[model samples]
Target: MGCDGGTIPKRHELVKGPKKVEQVDKNAALIARWNYCAISQRPLRKPIVACELGRLYNKDVVIEYLLDTSPEKCIIETAAHIKNLKDVKELNLTDNPAWKGDKVNTKGDKYEDLQGAAFICPVVGLEMNGRQKFCYLRDCGCVFSERAMKEIKTEVCHKCGKPFKEDDVIILNGNKEEIADLQRKMEERKLKAKLLKKAKKSKAIESCVKSARTEANALSSSSSSTSTTGGKAEKPGKPVSGIAK
Candidate 1:
């Protein structure tokens, strides 16, 4: 029976039960992570970079965040806790064959086959759509899959001929174990850079001291020469005075 202005209640409506929470769609989450900036959540544009923690971001947005002094405007506040721009590597992304650029279709549909992955590993062809692990070289900015890296096991980049150190490889969108390993690598790289900077500053200070000492010694020698010449000139003047015939 209906009560007031309400419709009839179902038999199950009278029974009390636990509330069911809506589950998040994994596909949507993956799509978002692959295409959007971790900090600003805007669609990633050219000059894309990855953090040591394996998060994707746009380079220009990162620069703006760094330049902005106000905390309110700072989107990548956690980025400050990061060492510097050196901590992030710019990605060398690959273009997908089946899709057009942002002018046509930036986002893909759920029903249709996903097209235009923002990035892919050059070595193993693993798309950077959050399916597999990927890493980029800090030295050459080349992207490659973790599997390819493990299989190849070389210090140099596969795509580029440039030499790279073990510290130059930084993972992007890595899982828990991979992320932990990446964090360790990041700390080690920063430590090495810090030590190098200190060594350079010490060397500069030593060089300055040496230069100053050399200049002072030259000045002292000049003063002594002038003093001896003056003494000789005084003797000559005296010879022309009372001692002169």
Candidate 2:
């Protein structure tokens, strides 16, 4: 029977257990990330990567999409200035068996269900949905949880066999402090590259100028010598010109 006053109050009105702030945040982030691939407009999958601009994409998707460029292979950029696979380090991402993220949830999926999924770290199995720290090696591009890198402390890349140093590691979407450091490094590198290119162009110009000057000098010398020889071979102005002074 209904209460004499009115209907009963709902649990949400009375109970104050916890909030869904974290879940809502995660849901929004994943929706933004997984909506589409930047280059191909395809669904994101394993071995995803981010460019220097920090746009996420599937490695395979980029490869196929780049085929359209043909002879002029795609010139992609990342933190390490990638041009191709050689320039990019294949990410060794972990598989989240708990949540495959394959089944399309027409309706909004709960945040807890997508936890540690979509993109997980190979070493620590942590989700890359902005909850924790993660980094990719500039030399190899192998991504790993910040915790794993800190705890492991190895010189070699965990995904690839290539050797790397502490400086080769770049954090993905790091905090303000980390972003400041990365920004400084990127700016310094770009400045150095610009200077080096200018130096090369200047050297090329100088070489061309010197070559042209040398050719002009040789031609001038030859012309003068030819004229002098012709004048000397005039046979002392000949007998016909004897009347001349």
Candidate 3:
């Protein structure tokens, strides 16, 4: 109902109360913390915070969406750093029997999934202008949003054959480039290790040469002392204190 001021009374105002301030939820706070660590290069804290936060269902959803979206045999982060428990936890999100393939109307589907779904990817709860907009990663097999696809020059994803725009799409070929770079780095490291090993061996050989020279000097000194004693031994039978000459 309108007040005498001609403005409609809020639901709480009619009830003689003030609206409560919305606070960030605990799960979201945990996820935010994890993301902060990832961006900050402090993944060492990930396990501790993950243990404390237990599990985030939404995080699982995002992971699954990433896996389904990527053309490669998708694993989280880097392949060599895979931890079994972590991966299992991530992959199990799709196993939620409660989903039943229903339309993800959490807020609303923004993009049209012409290939398969309107929104197959899970939503990341990011807020803007007092409203939450979920972010999703598109699959390589699918076309970008009709409007987004119109603006780009790329015809298709090189890895998965999905059509895309130059801007809306992330190319999977960059990952291959990264892999190649890593391989080159590894080769360089191996070469460095081999050189260090050779240097160590050379140092040991040099030490051995010095020790051999010292041993030869000691042997020569011992032989000279023996000769001096032999020269002085001639008078031993004649007198105990007599000189050898």
Instruction: Kindly report which residue stretches of model 3 are placed more than 4 angstroms away from their true locations once superposed.
Output: 1-44, 47-174, 232-245
Clashes in model 1: which pairs? none
Worst 10 residues of 1 by lDDT: 104-113
TM-score of 3: 0.27
Task: For residues 174-216, write the lDDT of model 3, one tens digit per residue.
Answer: 2356446534644565578789999999999999999999999
lDDT of 3: 0.38
Ten-residue region with minimum lDDT total, candidate 3: 127-136
- Candidate 2 residue runs with Cα over 4 Å from true position: 1-43, 53-99, 104-113, 123-131, 163-165, 234-245
lDDT of 3 at 14: 66
For 110-157, candidate 1 gives per-residue lDDT tens digits of 333344575677777776666777778877788888889999988667
Q: Model 2 residue 45 lDDT?
A: 64
Q: Give the clash total for candidate 1.
A: 0
Q: Which predicted model would earn the best TM-score?
A: 1
Evaluated at residue 42, the lDDT of candidate 2 is 65
Arranged by lDDT, best first: 1, 2, 3
lDDT of each: 0.76, 0.67, 0.38
